[model samples]
Target chain A: MIRAVLALARSDLFRWHRSPALVAATLIPALSMGVMVVALTYAVGRQPVALVIEDHGPVADHIIQIIRESDGFFLVERTREEALADMKAQRVAAVITIPAGFEDRVGSHDAKLDVFINNVDLDFSDDVRRSINEAVVEVDAPSLATLGENDLPPGTVSGIPNPYRIDVAERDLRTPDVSFLAYQMVPVLALLSLTAGALVTALAIAGEREVGALRLVRLSPVPRTAVVAGRLLGGTVASGALLSAVVLAATLTDVLSPPAGRWPLLMLLLLVTAVGSVGLGVLVGLLTRRVTTTAMLGVNVATASFLLGGGFTTIAFLPDFVQGVARAFPTYYAVEGVREVLFYDSMPTLGRNLAALTATAVVSLVVGSVALARVSARPH
Target chain B: MSSWWRAFDGGLRTQLRSFLRTPMTAFLVLILPINLLLLLSLFALTGYNAPTALVMGEDTAAARSYVEALEDTHNSFELRPMDLATAQDQLKRARLVAILEIPPGFEAGVQAGHTVPVNLTLDNVNLDMAEDVRRAVPAAAVIFAARNAFPEVRIEADLRNLLPRDTGYVQYLGVSAVALAACIAGAVLGGTVTAREWELGTARLSQLAPGGAAAVLAGRLAAAAVAGVVASSVTALIVWFGYSVHPVHPLEVGLTLVATVFACTMLGGLVGAGLRRVMPVAPLLIGTLLPFYLDSGALEPQRFDGEWLFALAHLSPTYYSVGVMEHAYHGLVVTPEPRWLLLLALVAIGLASLAALPRVARR
Candidate 1:
């Protein structure tokens, strides 16, 4: 039985090696994920804002300096007319204008700075608002001294040195802040393994069925269970090899870190994920019976799994209902587990995630084997 | 003229009949775009609500008031009251965006006219959301300080939005979603319809039957373009009426949609002719469209991102399509000379289509 399984698995691998298009199809998710990560790095944060400084006062210059020094605003110095035109053209997200005599009115408590924002996306506009507010606070209430000093009348709030001043200090939980690209790349790795395993397995079996080789196999003495196990093993090996190369490349490129001491656990999780994916692929192959249809089904299933499994965005950020829906996909557990082991250095729900993946693998394998046996039993 | 008309009519009818015969064709043509739009919109709607935990170590009147102050500040944080241990666990798992820890003696220090520092422990995995939390915390503090202490300091900073009204992030993304739908529909339908002929060995029959292959190809292209336009329009209407994203110039948006459909269909036809396989069309279209969507000023102005990205955006038709749609829908000229760029794209794609069709028909 072991010999027959090894022979069948070898043949499956040999057939896949002959088809470059099938290999290319399996690599599509990884390629797309790479492009998305690069694009996302450029897409988020530090929006462009045109700065029109009409005031030459010391305080106004200080405000301008503060805005320049801040990390949130990519400042473009422009004249008022130019700034307005740029804002209208959507070339810049917001326009900040420092009015003339803005410094002179500071002691009188009537200083006002105008901000014209293109509020197409409130998320971005809110960033601009916060940056401006920070600038104001820096100028007016430096070190909490000027919070209540300049504006107080002679005796109203007498000797009450800034009745109340709030100081905010933020600490990041992650030791080294994860870039958006790094954060998204972990799930992309899982997606790669899932897609490759499922696609290769489905296409291998479906291609055999399409060419009438499956009928010959049934006519032979090899059991159907051996054929199914062989195909699944072949697919798992191919997917595991491909994913290992991707991880190695990512580590070399500094896109991801090495697994450190968690390599064994990571390998185990990836192995389980690949087995589950191969089982699904075999079932799809048995159902479709055509290479093209099987490939299409594999692509669709992979895409759906990727989207719902937090491949593109964090699942925690999604709506409650969508998060609930995400729990159904095995890819979610694979991604969640991989991310924890790789980045967080601790597996919080390792048991639950492993159980889900193991169940998926067992169920899919059983159902797929039964279906293959039934199909093989028919007289051809 | 009569021969051309007959060939076009026959080809259109044949293409339509062929497409209707396959249920998968209908699903790809009609259902996929709507699904993508709905999914992408759902994604856009999320991630805006930053989950935060408020830990009140000192439960005093001032602490309670400060908590209330954070709550009242716009959709900044979805606050949950939890102990420090639970907050730490949640933060580690990235379940919460941040934890605003109000240390003991916060109220006492504030009431004694001293500076009370609030520690905000953040999970900076998503920098965009982290920036939101970082800025929001200080803004809320300023509001609290202004109301309590600085009564005479009246700094009236007038905020004038360039648009007539504020557009939510999801609404802004809806315009791009329509373009994405058009791109996918045009590519998948046009590619599949053209490629399936060769895959099923029906191209020879078409070649043997009638007038020049160009005319037949034109007819097929017309049918696919129409399907693309109709499917994308359904998505647009959902975004417009269902999502309350009313375009300022509805007629202009209609015109832009037609142009986008034509351009994308022709492009897809070129790819179909080149690949000449049914199975590769979907994956190829998806892979090609994703990068284009990202670099196409869909999220923000592409030029502002960087010079490298701006250079890449010029190569994608979706960029010009998104630019034209943004202008037509929201009156914001996100790209320079968008109408001219779209016209150039349409002409280029039309020429490319004419060149690629003979190759496909001959195959």
Candidate 2:
């Protein structure tokens, strides 16, 4: 049985090596998401705005500095006419102007900073709205805090009153901020494992059925268990190889700096995930024998797995029902497991993830082999 | 000309009938993108409200009022009332994005006519969510000041919006998803039929027919675009009725989709001709859709995404597709380029891809 399984696995790997198109089909989705992280990195937290300084006074300069310091807005130096042109052309998200006589209005307490925003959609406008609200109030924030904090001092310093005075004093709980792109890349990598494992196995099995090779295997002395075991072996190895390459690339480029000594754990978790997914793939292959159907459904199944497995966010944080659904899928454990290995050395759920994935693999292999035997026993 | 028409008619009729019978094709063209739309819309339904914890150390009127102001913030934070210890613990564990601590001021400072500071402890795990918290706090503070009706010097924003009203996030993404539907339909509908022809040796059959392979390819390409239109219409209706995003210029919206679908199907057909296999073509196009969606500014205009990313946006046809689609659906000109020019670019993409594929199959 061992010899038969090894031979079958070797043959499948050889065929996959020869069929570049089949392999390409499997890797595409995860690769595309890898490309997507770069774009997503830029899409969030940096919106370009044209800051037109109509007043070159010190106060106006102060406002400019505030806008410049804002994390959300990317300010470019442009003249008023230039800014207007950019705004009219939709070249910038918004045009914030420190209008002429702005300091005079501030002195008289009748100032309203002008903001002409291209509030195209709530997603874009909300960022600008919140930032602008913060920027405008920031001018009075320091004075208010200083005057209010002084005990029995003069009524005002730099002449800002303390009536109804309230300000925000921020205390960050974490030292270094994680880039959204890097955090999201973790999910993307798990998705790659899920896609490659299921897709590659499904296509290989589909190919075998399409060309009548499965009938030959059934006629031979090889046990059904050997054949299914072979399929899982080939699929897990392929997926593991892809996962290794991606992790290597990411680490080499300094994109992913997982803590030292975590690579082996990461490798183990992802490979086990691939094993479980490939078992499902074997069943998928048996169900859809045609290459066309198998290819389409393989992508679909993997996608469904990725989505149900806590896509782009934490499963524990999701609504209870959604989390319940996520727990039913193995990829969920894989995603959570990978995050643990990468971010924290001591993962509380590491044992649970390993147990769940191992059980899934065992169940899938048994079911897949039984299904294969049933199908082979049927009339041609 | 009559033979050409006959061949074209045959190819069109064949694909349409074939597509209706093919459940797999239907699943890819219509069901997949629709499922994505539904799943994604569910996420957006949270209205981008990030979860944060509020720890009220003081039970005074000032603290309560400040909490009220935080609630009034523009869908920025979903405030969860928690004790300071619990909030700090969640923040450390990365479960909560931030914790707003209303320290034990007791409103005494407010009664003394002094400014009191509310501390905000942020996890800052991901700067994207953290910054939203960072900005929302001060914005909330400003509101806190305004509600007090303070007689002190206060500056407000005199805002001028380009649009008459703010377009909702779902409304925008749902509309752009129609263009996405077009892409899926084009690749699956058009690409598959073309690849299936070669996979089943129908390429030779077309080669032997009247007007040669080119006429059949053209017919199939046209039929694919037409199929894409029908498939995407279902998506559009769902976006309209399901998501309630009625088009501002209904006729123009239809035309924009037609143009986008037409272009996409042709490109898909081009890829099909080159790859010549149904297995690789569908997954390839579907797989790449994510990057294409992001690059094309499906969620927001690319200019705001930064210079390098914006420059890369020009490489995707989706950039042009969403540009015209947004204008047609919401009357919002999202692109700096002329709308007509953008539409023209989509058409050119279709024509150019069609031109590149071997229409005649000379070999």
Best by lDDT: 2
Per-residue CA lDDT of candidate 2, range A1-380, in tens?
99888887788788888887887897887777667667667677667899877776666677778788876788886888999898886679888888888877876677778888888888778888888887776676654322112232322233344434765555554345566776668768778887788888888878778877777766877777777677778888888888889889888877677778887888888788888878888888888888878877766666666666655555555567877877888888887777677665357788898899889988987898788777766556
Model 1's CAPRI class is acceptable
Model 2 alpha-carbon drift over 4 Å, by segment: A137-164, A167-173, A259-265, A307-310, A313-328, A344-356, A376-379, B42-47, B58-60, B83-95, B104-106, B151-156, B306-308, B359-363
| lDDT tens digits by residue: candidate 1, A1-380 | 99998988888778777766676777875687678877777676677889889887677788788778767788899999999887776678888888887878866777888889877666677667766665666664443322211344311222333323566554565655666777778778778888788888877777778778777776778878887778778888888888889888877888777456887888888889988888888888887876556655665666667777776567887778888988988888988887777667556887888899999999998898788777767655
What is the iRMS for every candidate structure?
5.3, 4.6
* Candidate 1 per-residue lDDT over residues B74-126, each given as its tens digit: 45788889999999898887688888888899878877767676667777767
In order, the Cα lDDT scores of the candidates are 0.74, 0.75
- Per-prediction TM-score, chain A only? 0.87, 0.86
> Which candidate comes out best when scored by TM-score?
2
